[model samples]
Target: RSDRNNAIRSPTSIDMDHNDQDEVPTASLGTWIFLVVVAAVSFWSQATVTEERFVPALNVIANIFNIPDDIAGATLMAAGASSPELFSSFVALFITHSSLGLGT
Candidate 1:
């Protein structure tokens, strides 16, 4: 238990002087507007493509991989529903190069 605790306490996670908090940056109105527009476009494009193409493509991939029909249907359905989230995650990682992107 003690070793587990020690392992989790990285240099940044522990502070002897208690001065490790990050200051939030304030964005301008134009920046906020731009962020909103970008997010809206991302969501809209994801939805449009998902509805028109993602399911069919996923089916093709599953068939090519020789996945069982029963399991493939369920897996593809779940992936289809989560496509937006997966797309956003990739875009965030690319844009911010961070685990989590800038939150709105």
Candidate 2:
């Protein structure tokens, strides 16, 4: 048990964000609500930026490259949409030391 804990706490691992004391941390209801709100806003902002900026920029690139709209959407757009999954898989395998299986 101690060895497993030590492995989890190794320097290369992501910070667990806990105190040295062996006690569970607690959060108030207000704090939980605030965190939820912040998460929602963050997701909203990310989506807005991607839709407003990223996709249009890709479209411009496709035009500059003289790519057909269908081909561009099928290739570049599909790649753009799948990038988050690829990046998350990379993080899971490398940073989190987890396997990315079919479900992951």
Q: Which candidate number would show the highest lDDT if scored against the true structure?
A: 2
What would you estimate as the lDDT of candidate 1? Answer: 0.81
Q: How high a TM-score does candidate 2 get? A: 0.48
Compared with the true structure, what per-residue lDDT tens digits does model 1 show for residues 1-104?
A: 99999788887666654653555578999999999999999999998997789767877888899988788878877987877888888788887687764461
Which regions in candidate 1 have their CA more than 4 angstroms from the true location?
Answer: 1-24, 58-73, 79-104
Assess each prediction's global lDDT (C-alpha) against the native: 0.81, 0.85
Position 63, candidate 2: lDDT: 89
- The clash count for each model shown is 0, 0
lDDT accuracy of residue 68 in candidate 2: 88
Pairs of colliding residues, candidate 1: none
TM-score of each: 0.38, 0.48
State, as a TM-score between 0 and 1, how close model 1 is to the true structure: 0.38
